[model samples]
Target: MAKSKVEYVCTECGDVSPKWAGQCAACKGWN
Candidate 1:
């Protein structure tokens, strides 16, 4: 089976992240 890819999006800045983080890199907002 193929492995599924995961992504995290910031609601405030609409930034795409490969992994989950406490804050967004683009807007510096909490995720």
Candidate 2:
């Protein structure tokens, strides 16, 4: 079976992340 990973997106810059973060790496927006 394949494992599923969680993804997070930044509202300001539309950045996609593999894990949850306090801020967005691309736009530096708070999540």
Q: Who wins the lDDT comparison?
A: 1
Tens digits of per-residue lDDT for model 2, 1-31: 8998889989888899998888999988998
* Residue 1 miss distance in model 1 (angstroms): 1.4
Worst 10 residues of 2 by lDDT: 4-13
Taken over the whole model, the C-alpha lDDT of each candidate is 0.94, 0.90
Candidate 1 on 1-31: residue-level lDDT in tens? Answer: 9999999999998999999888999999997
TM-score of each: 0.85, 0.71
Show the lowest summed lDDT stretch of 10 residues, model 1.
Answer: 13-22
| Residue 11 local lDDT, model 1 | 96
What stretches of model 1 exceed 4 Å from their correct place?
none
Cα deviation of 24, candidate 1, in Å: 0.2
